[model samples]
Target: MTRQMIIEPAGQAGLTAERVREVVAAHPAVAAHLGAADPGRLIVGGAAVTGRDAAGDAAGRAPFRASVFDPVANRGVELRGTVAAPERAEVAPSAWRPTPGPDELRAAAQILRADPRFPASGDVVVYQPMPPLADLERPDGTTTRRPTLGLYTPGEDVEHRIVAVDTAAGTVDWSPAGVSPAMHPGDCESHLPEPVESLRDRGGPDAVRLRVLDGGTELWNLIVVRPRASAPQNPGDGSGVELREVRHRGRLVFRQAHVPILNVQYEEDGVTFRDWQNQETRFSATGTDPVGWGWRICTRPPRTILERPDNDAGNFQGVAFHDAGGEVRIVSEIAAGWYRYVSEWRLADDGTVRPRFGFAGVRNPRTCMRHRHHVYWRFDFDVEGSDNDVIEQFDEVAPGVLKATPILRETSRRRRGTARFWQVTDAASGRGYRIVPGGHDNTADPYGIADLWFLRRRASELYDGNPDGDNRAMLDRFVDGEDIGRTNVVVWYAGHFRHDQNAPHPHQGHIVGPNLVPVR
Candidate 1:
């Protein structure tokens, strides 16, 4: 039988009719309640009441006063205590439904498993060549080749080899064949075990050893593991789990090693020198230590060596020195002809050694100037994020100056797809301006080598003196009116070296130049 119900917020005594009507209209069974001819007869409150039907028909309403014995203070105010007119009652279809059973859920899962579109596990290995280098292109658009040291996977199980390619003949050559233990390529699946202690126990002591052979020398090394012990668990089933302890130890040894260049050359009674490669040399005194010094031969008069005050000087790329009593010892290796002197000494009987001193200068070669020439530009980017996505295409703004577009990405809290822009203009003339957008943020991706051709034209117009000096002036002009502290300008530089060939090393002459541009 259909029934109309009204529920409302209870007041001190009961609910008002207006609140009852608002509640009934918003109820899930609102349609049925509206169809009733005498909704007022369904009054719900803490006191009994009588009311008429919607058709103005007089009807006796069931008294619904809350019982004094009821534990709840106003039980009669609940919708359960309400009733509609007799004529409004009508049998209706059942709308209640039950939840899905276990069988149904299992069947749904099985269907999903059978679908071909379901995801499955697969492995992919990204192989990047070792010791990356850049290839240069000639004016004719022809590319010149550079030696790439090929791939060398240190911890892989499969055999590793490099195949040299000859572009002219379109052929390849392989060398230095080697193999590692079994490994599932791409999947990262191997005989390695978790809780390394357990794996070591199962694989035995020698399973994790690494062996290497060079020329006639052979070296073997082992992997070690250690585990912490856990306390005993309680007898009760509710007690937490227990853990085990383990440890590992390994060592490496070189078998039958031969010294390639062990000749020691001595000078007078105070100095001993060793030379390997015409340029690589080492020096030391009879009573001093030479544990970490570079090798160099003394080709000139013996100069007083001084110790460096700062530790940084001794730790420089290829320099090292230490104090030994009254005589200071020095050792250095310079690719180009050069000599470095280090010294340290105590003043008379003051008992204080003057802070160390170090000096480096070039020696005269057979000729005045080296004829070798290489042209290159140094580009620096003052970006905040990853080094890869920072710089954008450089557009020539003038003959030599160029500007790069800044990439910025929309953040989560802000509206999506918003673009970031860099406004560039001449601060003095207020001319030569450009606006570019679509730059990524410093977070997700970083700025790398970006082309800066836009500023070339502007740079040419501003050029009157040195290229670098003029470039700095032009940048200053663009930022004149703007507040430096408040604005964000991602600056970076890039350039290519050509003609001269040299080994890639940290302290190479070409790499030891000023790269950062002062913003002030």
Candidate 2:
């Protein structure tokens, strides 16, 4: 009662639909692929048809629902409509009718308005089924169910076994057969280093200390013992050195645990001692990148400072000290290929630190229209007790550049507020950029304007003596161009603010920040 039809390129010479079906039936794989479809259905490379209506003309148009199955992509796209010619001469027997409502009319209007935005036209109606009842299917094509039972107990591991349960009394009890012996804090003098007699004499029992020095540099020094524990455990034998109880004078600064070679000490002249452990410690500093990147760091305690060249392949390249505060800031001229582009840290007065980085900026430069330059610094620190905390503050210092070429223009209706200026496109990558409303003001004072002009003229000197000459080149490039001299870089400002509940239905007078980058 059913028949099969094959579809191929329309212009293929001497190729018949019946012959293609015979070829498909001869191959087992092709037959299996065809059998996977609904019975009495004929399938082509990209389309399928069911020959159920024998009386209907093969070319006659009919309205029937089509559900396309894409096995390779594991997707089903359903299209509802009758097959008809461009002139709609015939109607199909499978057509179904549904009552329309005002909501459907409005939805149709919205769809019509959005149709112009895309290149092609076809009513795409999607049907999404509810999730399956079972997440996994068993070998027998049924779902495996879980057991509903109380807590399970394995008898072999039971040390204190439960012999019985009193169901009526609603209670169960067990007893331990034995208890493990407690550990004692015995004499721990084996880890002590040989005590220096001369240093102990100068600082007394309360001042006996140890310090770590790196390459003759005093990193950290702290009191190791007090008078209360100063009594030598073995006395004259110099075996178990001990100190008495007394208040220690200096602070204990540990080196980074990862870098064992880096030591810490305190020094006045050139002499240093090994007193403190070279363990992880945190500090702060501030410095500009060799190529003009800016950075700042703030900490509660002093920190160890380390610096390398801008060409060094790491997160940190330079360092600076922010007065007496534990602030170490560094900036790198070139951005790292693997490191994050930018990060902002919110430092609270109560020692709580919140960090937010540029998560959206990690784009591959080959495909991305934007390029990011970043600078970063690191600190090492040590604190007493297990709960050491540091608060860090971060800010955006420089805005990156964006380039685009002009596209369309709006000339008339200027007073109606729909006019726009020049639109530019990037020559290298055909991405478009717009030059919206932007300007600069210098109305503070005549002398102030003069000073600003002079500073702008001599901005190259601000490069100072950084290792990267690229900083000077950037300054020169900014000053030499006419557009750079007159044009103001786009500034994007965004923040959260409170609004009143009684605001107008369509609020006006508030300008939301510009959408500079596309968010995926």
Best by TM-score: 1
TM-score of 2: 0.13
User: Residue-wise lDDT of candidate 1 within 146-205, one digit each (tens)?
Assistant: 221222233444322222222223332233122111212322112111110111111111
Give candidate 2 misplaced runs (Cα > 4 Å): 1-334, 338-340, 343-382, 385-520
* Per-residue lDDT of 289 in model 2: 25
TM-score of each: 0.16, 0.13
Worst 10 residues of 2 by lDDT: 231-240
Model 1, residue 373: C-alpha shift (Å): 4.8
Q: Write the per-residue lDDT of candidate 2 for residues 201-287, one digit (tens) a residue.
A: 111112233222334543333222221121111010000111111111122122111100101111212111111111101123333
Best by lDDT: 1
Off by over 4 Å in 1: 1-291, 294-317, 320-333, 336-366, 369-388, 392-512, 517-520
Worst 10-residue lDDT window for candidate 1 reads 228-237
* Candidate 1 overall lDDT versus native: 0.22
